[model samples]
Target: MKQQLVFATNNPHKVAEIQQQLGDRYAFLSLQDIGCTAEIPETGRTLEENARLKARYVVDHHGRDCFSEDTGLEVYALEGAPGVDTAHYAGPQRNAKENNDKLLSALGDRKDRLACFRTVICLVQNGQEYFFEGKCDGRIATYPTGDGGFGYDPVFIPDEGNGRSFSQMSTEEKIAISHRSRAMVQLEAHLKKQSDVARPTA
Candidate 1:
């Protein structure tokens, strides 16, 4: 039987991406699946803090083993101005196009386009918390491209993507080298170790 785990998110798309990454090693549940309707607060100053806040909320309120992740597109030129505020970078509305536009405008003709996508995942199990982090180094494009991804995907090109933005690639291609995928890999390894420890030695 697969170990059941709760992922602190209501978006089925996000859950699906993770399921694809982790395979059938575990049965993943979303916030809706666990009947959690409360909007978990993410009032943290950093990616790790935000992830921890969400994961801790689930453990405290729902009493479940849950995990949450926070991702940010940090640009070297911008000095990571929107690290924790990646979602609402443009305004309180959290408009993706506006945010991308703001990013591009701020970067206006700057020679340095170096950036990286970072993801921090916080896992709360049995009342204990653990963190896993991953980063994908890349650079921002001069203009937005592609129509397949959301947020900064259209303007960010991975170092290994052969000059193509994430939005230009298929879902499988993006996840294969995404920051979230790297973090998930670590989380899966940790869980596997714990499972092995819990298994009976016949």
Candidate 2:
């Protein structure tokens, strides 16, 4: 039987991305599917802290093995202004277009557009917590392009993507090189190890 895990999120885009990356290794469910309607608070100072907060909330309230991730776009020029507040950089409204415009405006005519996408994943299982992290180096685009991805995908171009924004790439292409994909790879490996250890030695 496939292992069951709860992903502490309601974003269908995120759920689809993760499901594609993880394949058939585990069965995944979102908080809404499990009847969790309350907004899970993300009141941490960093990505790891926020991930832990969400994962812990799901485990505590739902009593299930759960995992959560927090992603950020850190721009060297902006002094990481949106590191922990990437989702609400523009305001509490969490408008993606506004946030993108704000970032581009803040950049102005600066030649250096160095930035990185970072993701922190926290898994809570059987009262234990595990964390995984991944980073993808890239530069912010002056204008948003493509419509295939969510969040900063339209304006963030990964170094390995051959100058194409994440939104321009197919889901498979993005999954192969995204920060979240890298973190999920590590988490999968850890879970596989744990499963092996728990198996009976016949």
The number of the candidate with the highest TM-score is: 2
| Poorly placed runs, candidate 1 (over 4 Å) | none
* Tens digits of per-residue lDDT for model 1, 160-189: 899999999998999999999999999999
* Local distance difference test values of all predictions, in order: 0.91, 0.93
Q: Give per-model TM-scores.
A: 0.95, 0.97
Compared to the true structure, candidate 1 yields what TM-score? 0.95
Report the C-alpha lDDT of model 2 over 1-202, residue by residue, as the tens digit: 8788899999999889988998888889999998999988989999999999999998888888899999999999999978999999999898989999999999988999999999999999888999999999999998999989998899999999999999999999999999999999999999999999999999
Which residue pairs in candidate 1 collide? Answer: none
- Model 1 scores what on Cα lDDT? 0.91
